[model samples]
Target: MTQSMFRRHFRTPGTESSSAVRPLRASAAAGPATETIASYLNKRLAEIGVRYVMAIPGDYISDWVETLDDPEVNAGLVRVHPNNEMCATYAADGFGRAGGGKTVGCVSTTYGVGALNAVQAVAGAYVEHVPLVLVNGSPSVAQFNSQRDQGVLWHHMFDGSLTDLRIYEQITRMAIRIDNPALAPDLIDAALTACITDSRPVYIEIANTLEGYAVAPVSGRAKLKKSPIPQNTLSLDEAMSMVLPILVDSKRLVVLGGVEVARFGIQDRFRQMLKVLKAPFLSSLLGKSILSEYDTPYFSGTYNGRNSQQNVQDLVNAADVILSLGVQETDFNFSGVASADFNPLQPPGLPLQGSIEVRMGAARINAGLTLQDQGELYWGDIQLEAFVGLLQEVVCEPSGPAMQSLVSQFPALAPVQAALQAANGQLPNAPFPGLSGDIWSIPKLTPEQYRDQITWDSFKSLLHHNYLTSFGNDENQDAPVLLADTGLTFYNLNNVKVPQNGFIAQLAWGAIGYSPAASYGVKLAQMALGSRRRVISVSGDGAFSQSSNAIGTIAALGLDNVVFVMANGVFAIEQFLINAQAFNPQSKTAFAPFTRVPETSLWQWVKLAEGFGGVGYEVTTNAELADVLEKIKAGPPQPAQPNGPCSGSPAPGCCTFAPDATPDVRPSTFTLVAVRNVCNDLPSNTRWKLG
Candidate 1:
């Protein structure tokens, strides 16, 4: 029987607990094996919850990859081969992100050639605080020892056998070479533990020789023990004392939710605290959709410093205490790179007024995992997980004397204001009357009228209106995830209302072409959890080309995702950065030859999609786009991911093999939609201009 009892429920975004390390696997308590390094490592992987190890196989890693498919050897963990190393790494990243960093995404590749391709994506994971375990196969121990001593160069090797590990050392939290059988268990366990505890990627190297090497398994129960995270109690108490009164007495409070809420696996607490306190909440661009915007009261749209509506900015600036959770100054989006007026703790270039001017900005208070009270001295290392939990309890459950006393002083704050409501409520002197004051609902246009009004803003406005009215607002269900690739797409990511647990992006890393492949991995994770929510990925032409092969895998597997390829024929982001004036109406004629996509690079999206075994559509008008979107939404139930062996027919045109040759379980198919091309005179965002 499967270990369904241990099927970890990594809480959906905007929800969860602190003692959270989850694994998505069909596990079982298999007894200790005969002790080959392969068996031991695979057992550990199973225990840690890696359901699939995404990789592009190479000679050195072939043996390990093969062993993974051997159920007896791997305890049900499978080896998934994606299009390329970049795609594999992205898939793994998506898998981990979907699980809220509680479950780790594992990858394996060959020594040098294959491992190098993964560097950029792995670095992205490192920067984003994503947990992943990268396993690379190396030359046999004997070959490495003899060749290195004889000064011989190998096929996929650089200076030395440990070269790849050294390179990865800079990116991963742990980088170790497990050359000997005796050291495999501890080393593997340590690496996996670090991935989860630190919420960062780890690198593990296993030589081809070690695959079958006999090793003694750990003596007793095989589960690796989690490292006990100790917190500075005195400092935690001090921080609590300092923050409570400010929070309790504040007249207008706002909870500025951020990416850390999901990364730290504290979404539940964050959402709960927001409800109990009835505070207005705003998600940063990178943090959008972690919570549902539809039913959530007091929820404003994404906050981008000065880009926000004047009233939105003022609502934040005027807050007596703005609790900026999970945001740091290091974010390029806020570090004067995207805007000069993005600082939230000390909001919008205003001078501190009145007495009691002690600002506990996260930059000053928290250092990575350690949460401090005030100055660096009080940064006695109170762990964030511990601190957030304690804070949640104190705020959400105000039964304690101190908490009750504090709660009694604060008045109940209402949620998101109703439409057409006066601009004088929680949002003082607001220009508009909605959660997000920016949404301008547009009227539906006929085919003829849409011909003249086929612009970006028009389409966005119409789409949001359609989606808001079409989908059910069930707070309990997981919503479709929107994965935005880096480009002009970033500017429009949060233009519409986000459903609960809806929204995924690598914005901080800003990797173009990530969303396409990431959709594959996200679908895999969602399938494991029995969720059939469609993954909507938005990609620019440039970024989409980077990993368009991801569509092949998605189609072949019968996965359900909608890829909206904004067929902009050039790297618009490059033009924007090289000459900002190009975006202005006065400088619309500005041209940069390098930014123009060559004819060879442009994809006939429909042909490409068809060749990859998915339905494709090209829409140039508002009417066409709207009709296609509604048709997709109203289509048949998205096929559920199969847990058992592959069964049923593959998606039509997905495969040409004999009907009974393989029953690969692909119950549904993907659709590719090509929208209006933005080659010239594209949409521009003044707020995101270089500060």
Candidate 2:
């Protein structure tokens, strides 16, 4: 089909509905039992509570996009056009994470170019357990078949037929192509279910020709439900038998919670189990807000194996029994803390002295490359979802010897706030541990007290003490929801208290550009879920520059949010690693050009922010930042014009909003604040730092 032919499929927004896809009613029983494959997939997505399908327009995907009429295919599956394919994927990821496992996020993109751009976001979702669906539209079956006959191939294709699908198979829970329209609906259902059950991204590719191909309607089919974590009951019982006995005899049993807690929608249950057992638990890097820091007194800071701060390590070392609940087996998590800690046959030898490790799916205790045996103790589906509930029953219901053992240890370990006070920067802690923010007596430092010029290293003390207090204003309304981008930003947030389920980052993937775009999706999901939280995204300058296009949506929509750019004019995180020679200090050199991040002086951040539809502040001095921060706290400024945003976009000398002509009042908008820091101060803790 030509461009004009495809354009006819999408009617203007207010005009007649797209004739390309027939309407799908809520009660499909009254109508035909079949609908187009495009309608079927859209309905399925809506059934899974996917509110927004972030997409980018492309000829390959236009047919499928036309079928996405709200309440026609299904309600709640709105199409959102993002700045780019990458941002669209990131936004979907953010939505999925923020929805608390109750919803899924979908991304619609075209063939190779579009799908490849989203690779980083999808991989991050897989590693950190975020629910997502990537719908890719490719060339028609005729085009694909023509290529096999040695005819003209599509623009983005190689001679290989399954190349794109092969790439996605490595990252997603399921990667399926719908060449057979008759089977498309069933495949989509299975893929979506896998996305939810596995808490990972899935890919479904539909050829442009097959999108409108008729398939049996799925409206009368069973709606999505959480499938059971397929574990043999007897095997789980046996696994718990070996695990519970150690806990019964131990006095200092510590629970090492991880990302799976929240990912599986069991964080609340896990926190309750912790209270019932009177166990002090430390969250993993990805599970920083697994339990509310202020609410849970026994909740210690994040634990990233040997990468933990000295005090946190001391606490972990003192534990008599360590139960790892769904902790990942990544280098970032373990940091080469000796083979004895994860020996397959034998339990961890030291530190904990006893280790009980289990995950959401199966229980295995082997390092990735140097594994000897399978380490399958009782390997049925041993997810935390099933095990945590059973363990809570084993300890709480019957006041057995195990319960007595747990009781003796409580009120003994000092409360987290007390430990935090003693810590004094030795460990991460909630910035304000009380409801009224009175616990730490964090002072609001005057701007003049700090020097205007300092390296990134020198800015840490000021950042930790002064900046974080401006966030998380109260418990409910205007509560801060953080999207800390990759780099030192994640570490900084870990040091502060993240509101319950408030921290969203692609930590496992360490994709620098993720959070900035994702913050948009998060806000969108938050709006759908009826949340009243303000998103506060802090990103490194390099990371911000990578996906700053997403900022246009956030600013144009006028979301009352704050995005802090840690502007140091270089990829400071990598620079730090280079300074320490990537943790091998012996090879460290003095300002090597090849390794050092070339400083960038061009591309003024304020201009970038303004052009993207928000007011911006470039601050070299603390006072300027303080002034901008004050304006943020004071709320959106009155527009230069009365009833509308005179321009909305900030320009040359003054920040102005387009007018409804009241000269003094206009619409509210978001602000971008860039904190410019001096570069090249090597940070401490070179060996896999930043929990």
Candidate 3:
């Protein structure tokens, strides 16, 4: 079943090359040109309602980019602050994640070199079912035949660079080379249509020189509006018959969710389903904190720094039935199994008993409980919401006592409490001379210590719960606070329960640097909605470095929030590579480029904050963290944060700020101008010292 899904829908570049194509764009059949190619492109882009173009142009794209810069074009460009093709592609991928299925553009110079550099990111988008419009500039169409002069000897150019015939076909829905300037507009439209309609990346290559070349007649085309996502309807009788019995008979039932839950906008429906059944639920990193992140009885905590996979499996194996909503059998999820019962862990000779019911989209399976409802096939964006409604209509109480009773046997485990108590009930003093420890840093204390900290009031203390605790404040926030990027965090999180205003995460495409970019968008969304909720981005320092420039954006916006950076130098997930090669005991697993940034210079981070007109502080222990947060909450907001172009400028849209000022060494060398207030915007007269 999985192979069929991967094969039929996954179009390779070879197939596209062999298939004949027709143009759907406007170009003068045989007449004088009127509009510049750049003008025509801008007009077409505007026609498609695309205003944002993200890129770092090479010489090939300089003309088109410069054309776009003209006031006449008015197209917005997000000059991604990344050093290489990989990160650039990541920013574009992040842009798509936040853009909500709209075409978030990725532009690069022609030749297979640049395109090849971004192949991994493009592959991620394709495999994860994310839509990305990739525009690559190539050498001029006229140069395709001549093998002597320029392109023949060009440094980055390859013999068949214009048509990266070998690779593009493997990862994209369609890869087309626009050789005829006249046909480019139509080709562009077709490629874009393919991208949006198929919800995957499409490659449209334009000769570096042909980009925005004169087009006698510009094609009048509408940007392709994705068809309303088709919804897979289920037979009420069959669905209820299958699901109801599990609800009425199972004593230890659980629900699992993933990205599709959010993609389909069914978080609320998921919440309703969980509530009606009172089943303990768990979320994958892809589905982390969808509803909430604090503590909740239903949160199984199967994902995260601690491997709760066994705990999750225990519940699934023990239950008479397991219901999965929008769960994909991706390797990172479900350990590549359609059902946990079928997983390798059961005694080799032993027979498994329970069933796992999956209610999801088009992919098929021969699992214990399979809902082949075509509604799942419907690719409409609203399916999540629709699924929610369907789930609500069919409900049942727990088979017997609520599953909470089963969990009660474990009692409230307290790692932090025991740690504190054992340490004579005294917390370590602040690491720095003038701050307190951060209580939030204690994610792995002894079990007894974890149990001691348990309390009832959700508002006052950390609940003896899991990721599901962040849900419901329907009136205020509609999301979760914790936003984890596609680093170690994405794989182990699930059952997100964010408040109405709480934002769980938007890294649907499994790309790194997503959280950093999303942080800005989420904060901006909150501000636009007039919500004052505190936003938090808990990311690996590795991911933070990917879009570290965003720190400038945050500071500039003066977003009232915090970024809890996990300092572990390793890419946590890489360790799990060993799992992929189960047969090889000595499989070397390590993150590439094992370079470590000195821990001593984090003050530069503070400088980054101050540079953008915000406050920055460093802490080493939990106690100091708690104290700073207290001070932050109590302190007044800073003076208006200085604005930069595209975001947080004092004026509507000023691009005045730079992540690194002139010398670009200020942060690494500068010290706090003054520590007057941890929350203060750098007042004009503030002074600082160097590290």
Candidate 4:
């Protein structure tokens, strides 16, 4: 059969298409004999556009796994087995984030140990506001009843108490346990609804005995519709009444976009607001790529308090009024390590006094006006879409001549306009000097120097060069890039322009080793959705070593992804912080010894990649780096053929004991590029002192 025909044959009955799956409402007329709870759960997952479930198998979940494994009952949801529960959960988080917060990523783990292992990953997802459904298999009803009623013990039980659900409550938006099979459908719907509405991880514990139990057919009212966001016209009017004047009267108006802009899927609306105001905007560190730097004319630079570019700082600091949309003023988002002395109640340098801050579902305005009382206008549960839509409607537009006059009034507008023009002409051959901004000050180095010396500046320049020259402005063709948990990588790579919603970073939670593990899930989602974008995972040596085992899973699945390891022999960010803080070298504090990460001679990443059945390259210079990037941009690598079906043995081209015998027709290859760099070399312009 043709690929299209094969897909159609396996498509679920109620889903519109594989790419846009919508859940089907339960039919009360269809009796309990229609389908088992396991099948119902799988179908629900398919309805939510979950193309894959990243999971690790355990005895408790074996029955559910059997249902997932069965082609007839599994629908189109593919089950991916990762090396560990942590990797599985991280991959799910990546998948959800890459879907622009609409797609709900699913993961299944066995109870107790499995669920506990995934808590850290789920916590990261919670803080980052990525929606995920964690399906955990619990003890059977009989086993649980015996434990509770007869004081019997079971394997994986924690001190004779089912405390797993309690543990998850702290990290997830909802922790639901399906004790009665008849209420399974309602409970499942509640959990899924909470996951979608809140855009955070939710936990659902399915008793092993309930898998085959007959549940009441879902009511027709269960169809998944867009969850309603409570709106108040009076509050919206109050917000506009208070902030609109300040926005119009201010000489220099600036917009600071944050991660919620992307999480709420309002990039276009936010950009429209900028166009209406005709003002410059800067993205918060976590909100990088909320708007495409290349496509948006007014995008200045990323703002992170003291660590921001001097021009960006000057513009924002000097602004008459600032409008911060969906911004969460976290320590890292504002001042990074310098937040030690930074006050959260007030903005740095009292910017909040003149700022209109819109977050969650409320707008707070502080115009610094003498007679007005600064207060918050609550919009109930109104989402960013509705809020931005209101702004677009109410915002007054200027005539062509008036806009021109307004543009000419601000002295800072010239640099922003110049930067936009320069960015437009920044082709591969464009002179580095022509790029006129503090952010564009890339180090000029010859090819020989690029190859001979791998300094921090040179590495960043090469990355920016490759990204700008190769990727261009075509977001359609570009894949999402995942940045590991390290300040060095994030600060340096901030200059590289990404399309809106094309960058993923664990900024708020800052979990190390997330990039490599999460890249697998991101790539899997992209492939399932029929996107051709390549997955790029960038990690520091310290971060890479923590999740190096993920390379095996990447190779095993034959995923076409690239892992770039910045092999800077130490935890450079920590060292930089220690030095900047003037921590005593002889002191017995944890920071003293922790700064020096022990070097390992045996930990050759390239060799480890080869052992995991992937091609590895050690890039010492720009020349070698360019070659590897060229190959990646060209296409995915050919699939390695397995020696035999389900054989747990190593083969030249195939993954051992691979679950899917049918190789991805598209070329699938993995590459680990180890870029050697100086141990203590920090990104230029890094500010480590507390504000």
Top model by TM-score, which number?
Answer: 4
For model 4, name the residue pairs that clash: 640-653
TM-scores, all models, native as reference: 0.80, 0.80, 0.59, 0.83
lDDT tens digits, residues 531-604, model 1?
Answer: 66678888877788789898877876787788888775677777866776665655555758887756324667
Candidate 2 overall lDDT versus native: 0.67
Number of clashes found in candidate 1: 7
Q: Which candidate is the best by lDDT?
A: 4
lDDT of 4 by residue, 1-691 (tens): 4665333322322333542433333332344455656777777777776778887887667666656666656766787878889888988998888766556788899888898999999999999888899998887666777788988666787854668899999999999988676788888888777787778899989876456556555434476544746676556644554454455456667778889887766777788777655667788888887877767857787887766666777777787677788887776666543354756675555376677778787776664631355343444444567667765554432223322343355443334334323434221111211112754556666757755647667776766666544666655657445554555676666656666666777877888789898888888777766676677888888788778788878887888788988886677666655565322234343445565445434467667767777778887767777677777667766665443343445557755534743233222279888887765455665643422
**Which regions of candidate 3 deviate over 4 angstroms?**
1-51, 75-84, 99-114, 148-151, 163-166, 213-223, 228-255, 264-282, 289-306, 309-315, 335-481, 486-514, 517-535, 542-562, 568-614, 631-691
Off by over 4 Å in 2: 1-30, 69-71, 305-309, 334-353, 364-380, 399-448, 452-477, 581-589, 594-599, 636-668, 682-691
Kindly provide the TM-score of model 4 when superposed on the true structure, using C-alpha atoms: 0.83
Alpha carbon lDDT at 383, candidate 3: 42
C-alpha local distance difference test of each model: 0.65, 0.67, 0.46, 0.69
Judging by TM-score, tell me the better candidate of 2 and 4: 4
Tell me the tens digit of each residue's lDDT in model 2 across 1-691.
5654344432221223544444333233324454767778877887776888887887777767765643455344676778898889988998998877777889998888889888878988888889999999777666777678867666776663767788899999999999887688789898999888889999999876566556776756788777755766666665655555445545566678887888778877887787666666778777777666656757767665554555566667776667788776554454436453455876452353356777867753323211246332446467677788877765554344433333344333223223323434212221212122232222344555554654343344444454445554445635567788877666544545566677776667888978888887888887888887778788888888888888776764456777888777667666554454533345544544553333336767777766766778888766666566667667764421222344455556766544421123224376777887655444333344322
Q: How many clashes in each candidate?
A: 7, 13, 89, 1
TM-score winner, 1 or 2: 1
